[model samples]
Target: MKQLTIVGAGWAGLAAAVAATQAGWHVQLFEASNIAGGRARSLQQSFAGKPLDNGQHVLIGAYSNTLALMRTVGLKPDELLKRIPLDLRFADGQGLSLPNWPLPLNMLAGLSRAQGWNLKDKASLMQAAWGWHRARFECDLTWTVEQLCNASRLSPRVMTQLIEPLCLSALNTPLNHASAKVFLRVLHDALLGGLGSSDLLVPRVDLGELLPNVCVEWLRTRGADIHLGTRVSATQVSALQHAASADSAVLLACPPWEAARLAADIAPKWALSCAELTHKAIATVYLHCKDVGFNGLARPMMALHSHAQAPAQFVFDKGALSEQHGLLAAVVSACTTERDDVTELVHEQACKQLGLVNVEVVQTVVEKRATLACIPMLDRPEPFVAQGLWACGDFICGPYPSTLEGAVRSGQQVVTQISQVTHR
Candidate 1:
């Protein structure tokens, strides 16, 4: 029987284990953290009598691979997540909000009915969109998102309320620094992929319950070994490598830093490549109002007016989405501020913008290295590090940016590579 040992039980690692196990490979999964979701895990800390997540994440209907993985573990995506139309409205409803209609119609309807946008602003956006569609969403390698916006002649209003927020949320990098190629790819997949590809999928459950916990259970039933709260040392991995048969392989599904540390001796070039990649931080500030039934926003999620002081770009109403009544989470992507400042500023922003003055900060979760700083023409490491060593993560060489779907695709790609090698 073929044997595969995977390090790190994050989304990437968990997806690899599931794929390998289904492919009839004996799998062993290890995670350094007690929980399996890594950066997206649920925290033990309570806010408004509800569990908090490390970060607030939103998946799209275009995340086909991730949705398929959820079903593979016997979980329904529709049940675990609340599907809503693409709504990028602010507290005052001054942005684009797509109807639940089909592709082109929904986009057109939303664009036409966009609040606070003049005819010129809407026309400018339409022109830019048509240009991108004509070019097949392909852009120059050296171009940043800001450059793309300039070339497309997008208006300042569209840039501030729409493009900037989308770019920041998707890439977790600033507009001037984010890769235009990656940003265009994301736009293509969401806008042109399918009928409901652009729909927002908000998790009704915590991050762990959404996928990782159930995946672990599914793997356990299939005889796959899972080790949580334990790190796989280089010496132990080397010992396993010596004792294993020819059909056995080692897959590093850990974060880039840990993967670099493990593969440093075996593949110094790959390690150096991993080490050179920079990362960005994401901060989620949880807030709760005194009155549980008094909803502040018009929708479950509202886009914020971000500036120097107000760092949060988007805020999600946990009360409406997950039954965490009175709970709200403001998300600050590519956040560079300190924790204390972020919490205070977000609280003030919510009060000033959303009209929730009685809300108090429940918890502030800051992931220092939330995602790879997806810059223009960044060189990412390949999966095949050595003869029998492999690595998989969102940071792996892929078309997508550092996202859950990217991580899942990378994980599945490693399994496919392994299968191809074994068949040969």
Candidate 2:
């Protein structure tokens, strides 16, 4: 039997393990941390009298690969997630909410009925949408999202209320630096790719329960060697390579920086490129407002107007999604400031924007390197790091920022590559 040494038990690694095991390979999964979810995992600490996510992550219907991976692990997407229509409902009552209808019509209705937008703004937005649809939402690879928006002549209100939030959330980089092609690909897949593709998927359970924990059980049941809290070193890599038969392989499904370090001797140029790739930060500040009488946002998630003092782009009521009542998670994408400052700023922003006072800052998680700084024309290494040693992660997933879906897709792809190798 062919054996596969899969390093890093993150979602990507877990996905790869599951797929490989199902394909008749003996898998040995290794993780540096005991936790499985990597960036998407939940912590053990009790925040605001309840368990909170490490960060607030929102999935869209366009995350087909992630959803499929979940299903493959025996969890249904619709059952586990609080699915809702595509919308940017704001705290101050100025946003766009798409109807639960089909593509172009839903988008048209959303654009036309967007609150606080002038007639000219609506017309300009409609025209831009029409053009993008006709053009299949493709854009020049070298252009920034800001450049594309300007070229499309999008309304300032639309840009601020709708486009900016979407760009920041999806790309984890500001529109000025984010790739227009990547942004358009995401937008096209969500808005134009048939019914429910634009729907928001808020996790009803913890991030770990969504896939990682379930994946561990699945891997264990299949008799795959699971090594948690174990770090593989240079010696082990060489040993594994020497110990394995000619048909065996290694899959390094780690983060880009870690991958760069591990593959330094194996693939120096690829490692350098991976190491040089810049990253963006994401901060999720959880607040407990148990006394707030207001019924959360207009929807489950709300976009908040933010300035330098108020860094939160969006706020979610955890109570609305899960059993965590009065718990709100404010997300600041591409965050660069300190966690304490972000927490305070988000608290202030929430009080001012939502009129919710006495909000207790439960926990503030600042992922300094949350995602790759998805700039225009970013170059990434391919999945094949070497002959038998392959690599897969969010960074290797082309055309996507560091996202759960991207990670899952790359994981699945890595298994496919391995299957081909085994067959050959």
Candidate 3:
């Protein structure tokens, strides 16, 4: 079996390790943090009184690669994730729900049911969908999301209820700055892929318990070496004349910045590509409340009012854990300014927006640089870096936005490349 070293313990690295091991390769996985899940890890705090995730993460039924990886680790989808139809609730007490419907039509119905959308807004949305379909068929990459949203004349209701949240969640960039091509790809897969495919799957447990920890156990059972808290500083490749060996095959599945630094000497081209990849930061603030006025809210997850005083982007109620402790969490995405005052502002917002009066603020966990900002139209690194070194991450693949699905899909692509090269 070929000896392969996989760097980083994020979703991409873990998925690559699993695939390579299953394909009869000797895999050694390394992680910089003591934990394995990277941004998706969970922790136990005094205030929450239970384990809490750095932020809330969700998956769609259409995410086949992520679902497949879960199966590989002996995890049942129904048990690990709470799967339900697409339900979105706005801050203005308006909501929209999409039942399990067939492709294209499913998205159409969902948009039509959206409250507060005027006739002109509906027409603009239809025009945007038509344009997206046309662009996908023609493979046109020239237009950006800013241009499309403008040309379509989308209403504020459609923009906030549909576009803004989706863009920030997927791309980690605002709509005006995100890539239109990649956004279209996401729509094509989930919205146009047919019924139940667009179902939203939220983790009922902490992120670490949900996937990464399970993955670590599964890999150990397969006899793969899993090394936590091991960081790879650099990678050196043997001269071409020396010929690649079993140990030559190394998979560098890290963030774009780290990957670029590691591959600079070994693969200059890949290093250059990595340097071209841009990133943005996401901030998530977790709050513990003693009492919540609303019950369950509309859905497990709800987008916050961006124009509010505190201006939280999303909020999740952990009241389900009242059987043990009283806790609630909220998230703020694309936080460009006011890093110092974000926690205080979010705390105030939770009280005013959620109507949680007399709630004491116990714990606040802030992930300043939660995820790399995936902008539209920015060039990303390719899968194959060198004869043995490969790159895999959400930022390396096609324009599907930076998401858990994209990360897993990128890992599978690297595995395929490694398999073909080794077999040849």
The numbered model that scores best in TM-score is 1
Question: Which structure among the candidates has the greatest lDDT?
Answer: 1
* Model 1 lDDT per residue over 1-424, tens place: 8999999998999999999999999998999899898777888987556568999999998999999999999999999999988999998989999987876788789998899999889999989998999999998999999999999999999999999999999999999999999999999999987878999999989998999999999999999989999988977766665555559889999889998888887788998999988999999998888855686557889999999799999999898888888889899999999999989999999899987657878889999999999999899999998877889999999999999999999999999998898778
Which stretch of 10 consecutive residues in model 3 shows the poorest summed lDDT?
235-244
After aligning candidate 3 to the native by TM-score, how far in Å is the CA of 225 from where it should be? 0.9
In order of lDDT, best first, we have: 1, 2, 3
lDDT, candidate 3, 127-198, per-residue tens: 877876776622336656666677667777778777877777766777777776776777678776666777
C-alpha TM-score for every candidate: 0.98, 0.97, 0.90
Q: Rate the local accuracy (lDDT) of all candidates.
A: 0.91, 0.85, 0.73
For TM-score, candidate 1 versus 3, the one ahead is: 1
Whole-model lDDT, model 2: 0.85
Clashes of 3: 3
Could you tell me which residue pairs clash in candidate 1?
A: none
Model 2 Cα lDDT, one tens digit per residue, 1-424: 8899999988789889988999888899999998888889989876545567789899998899898888988888888899889878786667889988987688788877777888888887788888888888887879998999899999888888788899999999998999999888898888765788889999988888888999999989988999999999966776675565566999889888888888888788988988998999999998888564756555678888977898999888887888777788899999988877888888989889888777888889888988999998889889988767888889995766788988988898889987887786
Model 3 stretches astray by more than 4 angstroms = 44-49, 103-113, 134-140, 235-248, 292-295, 321-325, 362-369
